[model samples]
Target: MDPALSLDSRVATLSLAGMALAWSVGLTILSIAATGAWEPRVWAVALLATATIVVARETAPLRAPFTAQAHLVVHVLACTAYLLYTNGSEGSAASRWLPWIPIALSLLIVAMCRYRPPREILGAGLLSTSAIALATMPLVAAPMPLHGAPGGALVLTAVLPVMTASVAAACYSRILVANSERWKAQAGYSSAALEPALLSDIERVMYRERVNALSGEAFPFLRRVLDADSISAADRDTARDIAARIRSAMVHEVDRTWLQAAVDSGPTGVHAPVVDDPDACAPMMSGTQRAALRTLISSLGASPRLDRFTISIRATDGTCRGEVWARFRAPYRPPRRRRNADLAVLRVAFSEVTVSTPADQLIVRFSFDHA
Candidate 1:
């Protein structure tokens, strides 16, 4: 696994464990005080239940598809079971309302899970109103208890656990957000470092095309002479076979007249226009150069957002300097040279390649030196 993903998993697990610990400890303390029996027997039993829950929570991390929702359900059930066993409707003020405290904490967990929902504000308002209504029910429905006395202390103890649990839930959410941002930043940096390598590879393919056009032998033994140390066997075979044939076939037929035939001609299968063009402008283009631009434009078709594309070459002045232009629509990235075989070919035909964007328009202009 990637280091970033591993770190995020660990942070998420710790956050869930923290919430579980806060809830378990709060309930344990409240239960001991309300019953007024540090009697070794009952106190030990309550502590044991808290320990069991804390340990169980660690094994069930929050990422098992439905695990988070299931864990919440288990936590809610544990709270209900603990309250019912320790202080069922004994009509005792301390134990009678203990169940509601955990109920409020469970609701806190649910609200945390839906932090960015559109109804979060409304849901929270409703929850706060519900907790107030539920907590005050005992006082309103029954006789008043004396203030600043044992009964008042018991009431405060029941509410304190719910309040502390809310704070812990909020803290857990902030930590999760921070960790997510950290992972995204790391991934972005790694992607940027590979861009230069891709550009260099494109340059290598363009030169290979020129070498192939000059050799009658379909495969060049030139790979060993150029970079025997770093070149792989598979790449050497492809380079030699493809470049030698290209050189032998294209060297004699390529010239100014041959290029003009392509410009005046319509749809020779060598150029696929992104937009319909009756008179293609790339008349002075060499066969390898035309092949290159065609490759670049065809690859753009794979990108769903790239609606239309065009590359036209025009000669200017007495010297047949070629200009290639292309436009790609929004929500698409420029074709990478190494990946788009066509652009790699066209690039060798020109001395310089310039890309520009003004407003929503994307332009790629290729400049050929005087020839």
Candidate 2:
């Protein structure tokens, strides 16, 4: 699957999971409120169930599929007990009013789940409000010993909304912070992966320019091909094909720019093919070849100027033998004696960095003697 598509799927799944959790909690709370009264034990259990669910909203117990589902089950069971204790009647004033507290509390949990609030804040809010909501029940319900206490009206009207909304705000704030962290991580990965490849390509081009700076001729059509203006598909294909062919043509020339482009365009990541074929060149290469290859690719991949240029190294007998191919972008000149000197040094380092270009294909090969 495409990376972008995979990311979209994950986002959708998280959203659905969050919504389902909220709905389940809300329904349980409503069911409890519809009951008129309940036995002392049953009421206790019902309050416990609500507390369990609300507190676990984003915690390990709540986030895990099995644990969350179990909490919801408990919520429903407690609500059922509340209804049974009340004799299945919904009209009683005590019953009609009791539902408001749990419902509001549940709504707060739902909101936090959807928004993915901070774990610490969510836990604290759930625990604190559950304490308040459960306490309010006896004050409003019958059976004076455990009922008709104090502050029943205030708990229902003012406190519930305020507490729930506070939880919601905390949840929203947490979500934003989490998202910001993810963005920073992604940005770091992109930089570490792509920058090196770009810099590697650029360094190779610069090295070649240094050698040939005295005198060289630039390719005529290179600039037009790289220009950003819109063009037909066919033209684009044609341009790519031509550049590819040019890259192929220069394979025997041992040009740094062309080789750099080839390596940079292949793949990007902290872990990637840095020196083209380090293994193939290993056996013949001295420390210098390895160092040069690493430096060359790193500089080119990080640099904009070398991105469009091509670099090719063809090796024979584990050393640079025949040709080094480089296709410079248009308006960039090739150096005069630079070519000869590069060829000679590459030949001298033949065992370490041999360049070879066969009739039709260009290959960079290295080998390191493990023994």
Candidate 3:
């Protein structure tokens, strides 16, 4: 796992800054004891500074982006310089044992994995590895043991970390992309899954409306009856009339489907979605498909220019075809990108789906199987 992810972008942690400083000091000490040379130590300073800068910049949101080629080039040069310094280490295991430059470069690449996509990381890693190897292959001294291979093969050992990091970044990046796309796809369905609450809310409103109707139409008359000083022919006639009207209303409301209730239960009194499913195809659709429609409709509602939308479902042969067509006020309409995504979701949910816009209108036609 990449530990760099844990670092906050707002502030660079003291521990990392301290680690970079210690690295520079350690490499400087090794150069003195091993080669007594100033060249390697100088290169160590450059590499340490470059690596620290990369890490710091990546963590800082307002700083230079990780994709900047300039940073990559500086890092490569520093790595190459360190490789040359390693060559000056004679009669000692300092270069062979520490190999700090390549190690640091590899670690930097790993840290970068948290900041950018895999392809960019792969490119950066590979470029750094190849550049350093090319720069140092001719300048640096080759180890004595080739085992029949060319002397230049030692360059590979110095850069192997970079190569590994490149491949790892590529694989890691692909996973990140795949996961992101999946998240975008599933987000709609998850939001739509809240349809139960919407339906429950609609039911609550319907119950309240029913109660209000009874209170308004019959309750007042019943109160008058309870408080009557004496019964009369007119009272009997009024009670019979109220009884007939309430019975008629109850029967009518009972026969209306839940789909109709949902359709007419728009948030706004005007410009509500119009339904045209004479065959009542909504109740027959799979819950998943129905949820998708609900999500699509809810998303469309966000657009202000939407005058009115109609959900028309018809039975044909053995299948139920549906179309959700919405007309705008005029030239203004929803953006193509957002509309495409909404339609894409319906396309996935339905067996067949098509979308079209014929001047001031957005239409999505689809078909689905029964539950």
Instruction: Flag regions of model 1 displaced more than 4 Å.
Output: 1-68, 82-136, 139-156, 202-217, 220-371
Error of 2 at 119 (Å): 16
Off by over 4 Å in 2: 1-371
Which wins on TM-score, candidate 2 or candidate 3?
3
> Which candidate, 1 or 3, would have the higher lDDT against the true structure?
3
- Write one digit per residue (lDDT tens) for candidate 3, span 45-84: 6667666665665444222233446446546655665666
lDDT of 2 by residue, 1-371 (tens): 11111222334434433453454446445655554233443454455445444434323211222233343443444344433433433333353434333444444344334333355445545554555555445444544412332446635652465366547756665766677678979988998899989899889986775445322322433455468476678766866776676556456345434334445455554222333432333334464444444443444344332313233334544344322333334444434222333333232333333444333322333323332
Q: Note the clash tally of each candidate.
A: 12, 60, 0
Minimum summed lDDT over a 10-residue window in model 3 is located at: 1-10
**Pairs of residues at least 3 apart in sequence or in different chains that clash in candidate 3:** none
Provide the TM-score for each candidate, comma-separated: 0.34, 0.25, 0.44
In candidate 3 the C-alpha lDDT for residue 91 amounts to: 29
Q: Measured by TM-score, how close is model 2 to the native structure? A: 0.25
